[model samples]
Target: MTGTMQLAAEGASDHRGLIIGLFGAFVVATLAITVWAGRQNKDADDYYAGGRSFTGFQNGLAISGDYMSAASFLGIAGAIALYGYDGFLYSIGFLVAWLVALLLVAEPLRNSGRFTMADVLAYRMRQRPVRTAAGTSTIVVSIFYLLAQMVGAGTLVALLLGIDGEAGRRWVVVGVGIVMVLYVTVGGMKGTTWVQMIKAVLLIAGTLLITVLVLNKFGWNISALLGAAAESSGKGTAYLEPGLKYGISDLSKLDFISLAVALVLGTAGLPHILVRFYTVPTAKAARKSVNWAIGIIGAFYLMTIALGFGAAALVGPDRIIASNAAGNTAAPLLAEAVGGGPGSTGGAILLAVISAVAFATILAVVAGLTLASSASFAHDLWANVIRKGKASEKEEVLTAKIAAIAIGAVSIVLGIFADKLNTAALVALAFAVAASANLPTILYSLFWKRFTTSGALWSIYGGLASSVLLVVFSPVLSGSETALFPDSDFAFFPLSNPGLVSIPLGFLLGWLGTVVSKEKADPAKFAEMEVRSLTGAGAH
Candidate 1:
């Protein structure tokens, strides 16, 4: 027994070295890209939109990388591994959300927007107030999303390096924060896009590799794999059905629906994802990017089911739950198990590579979020709001870099504080806010002729405030052992997610404010925006 324990310890040390080495390689590669991007970035256009240089295929891959954050790759797979079929519903909702982006948002937004989402939103409205509202929503959504990625980063590092305690996790979070800030500050959008594109390819390749290996283990029979997963989940065949993670009660059902609503609408409104549209040259390119993104993202999510089930079948729920109750380590453990166990060189290498990929996913996502938030700050607030649109392109880009640092600092603090929270829940709240706040205002502005500045402000504020307040009082924050605040139950709101209530309230507020306001409709501005959005006439 003593000899066996010594050998296990040695194996763990070997794995750590491999994981750190791979992570270093990824960092060096991405930083090189950032350096090159910095040299090429000549103006605000390059800093914000990569000079609109990326092709549809390139932008599409970058978009997929931005959208497929650690939450989507690790959290979703972990959820499916832990809860079985119920977790797969999230994959469906996320994939379906791209349809919302492709059909309703991509072309019009690319045609109308320049740097930030506020550009498109403020075009036909009161510039200062509209931009301010959009900026606020962008910051809120991005920060929330950033927090999740950062926390996931910390947890991921701790898992990969076999670190213990809050101190190690905090350091990991800070390191991730600094790296993300550097990526945004140095590379801006151009550098960040290339980093994401690279990470996307690596992420897809890693997922595909593990999936194929898992299938090979089961003789390439998916049915056999599912059967084994169900058997090993301890719940037997019941694991193959829904309602394990949700649908236990009326409120649970409502929470599930709310989660679905958020995932379906939120992807269209996420600032980081929407900004990808502006990275391409034209509306046609933007539309093509969305189509390509749909294919890539859809295929990735489908593969996640196999990864998740393979983890369940091979690694078992007992091991996964022991490692992390949230199952965040399922994929890594699955890699270890499928590659010949943690004792072997193959297992150590595969786990390390996947770990590196997960870290890259977090880094790319956080960089995009930071860029989106900083762009909103520099473009909408600093340039237009504070300077009255007189700020030079150089000053705007500089302000963006500063804003990235500030946002990264705030995210570090928030990430450390929220490290124990579930990654999927944190991401869901971000989506709820995006769906409820950003989407309503954007849809009204783009499609509704009667949408007023008053309506836009109302929608943004109403939805933002509601989502925040509800989440604060929701069960996810308290009321249960898994809650972020598990010691006390201050959950006045029964639902875990607020999208069901807040989303409708957002749209309602938009229409009601427009109808009730004494402000007259600006028909000429609307007509101009409509023509520009539809035909790309006079669009920059």
Candidate 2:
């Protein structure tokens, strides 16, 4: 190892005491917040929606906290350092996605749903079938998202501890799973929202700090930074161009398009994000909440221009890949470089603080995902479908807590197997699943008067099965060097992401099922739903 490399390893070990202290401090603070929030849970509303008490600005910060996961901080930076322009494209897809959520879905979703997405779908359809399908889709999409966040957490803990193998990452995954379970089962939405609010502030502050430092390194010259990044990338101007990563072959191009489609459409469909709308009191607050999020998130992504290219120029792509093959440690390594060289005190402090923030990002997102899935399971599936709305309020909340533990266990197992994949790419797959399975159902339920229960079932199940099936057979899972299980070779799908095919198919399935169904639409119910969804009349 070179001097900086050796010092980096030593610095990580030398600061082990500091690193662990920051980690412990963050955990204790968030746990205290969670426990305190738990006392506010006097009813189902408080448990599920934080009593709809948060202001637009507060909820917006929490949304930013929930939305900006490890993928935004670590994965995107690494991608930019390695792949150049294509890596920054992830930020674009995620940012523009909010526009869809804002203009089309946010107001109606907030007004129509009480706790879960199923509340909207079940309003004008057969309750049991629609609720069951919506509940299942919610859990699946949440798990896919949870898997990516946990994988990022595992990589982060392994790097900070200077652990060299998958074994260490696996232990981190297990530990994170336990902590997130506690966050949800004890704190519920109130605790989760507060933690996310804190995390969002830290993430923005940390990213802003790095962005300013990178600019200072180049004497505040943007051109110099880009020139150095391109030169250091070893690919000249190609690094700044579009084709560096995804422009290699037609298949790769198709995969890139698929990923873009998923990212843009997925935000509106995400169960956790949709549930966030219900945490506010009115349609106006929901709109205001989204407005705040778009502004904060837009500014943050703009800063990634510095974060990604800064890493490329200072840390070098070779050194970044050396640290983590997926470049998941790019941000921290860049933090270390800008603070000073590896062994410097400044480097150590910035590295530990940034890594702690990244860890907090992982914990906050996982808690939100657990709450979304578990709430759906208890509210939609257990209480409504199985118990026929006979379950008590306390019984439903108890079921949600149990579901959090079970879901956490499943996430731990999957996360251990997926430690090698890029966090951003894994998150894109989650987007694809959400876009394919949940988006169609949501749009149809809110807009199409003739949409029937059979249509919802078919759309949810068909889109979900098709997306997962294609993913299972795609090169992302096997048959490639970067595949989750590279030793296996059963993949036959041409594209890495299934969105190019699955999203369109989901829409088509919903329409076809609606036309073919023998069940008749009830105009009275549809009219009631339209009014409630439009004006927030009689919403819980």
Top lDDT hit: 2
Local accuracy of candidate 1 as per-residue lDDT tens digits, 431-508: 999999999988889998989999999999999999999999988788987777789898999998899999999999
**TM-score, every prediction:** 0.97, 0.98
lDDT of each: 0.89, 0.92
In model 2, which residue pairs have backbone atoms overlapping below 3 Å? none
Q: What is the lDDT of candidate 2?
A: 0.92
Question: Lowest lDDT 10-mer window, candidate 2?
Answer: 1-10
Instruction: List CA RMSD, all candidates.
Output: 2.1, 1.3
Clashes of each: 0, 0
Instruction: Give a tens-digit lDDT track for model 2, residues 79-133.
Output: 9999999999999999999999999899999989899999999989999989999
Off by over 4 Å in 2: 1-7
TM-score of 2: 0.98
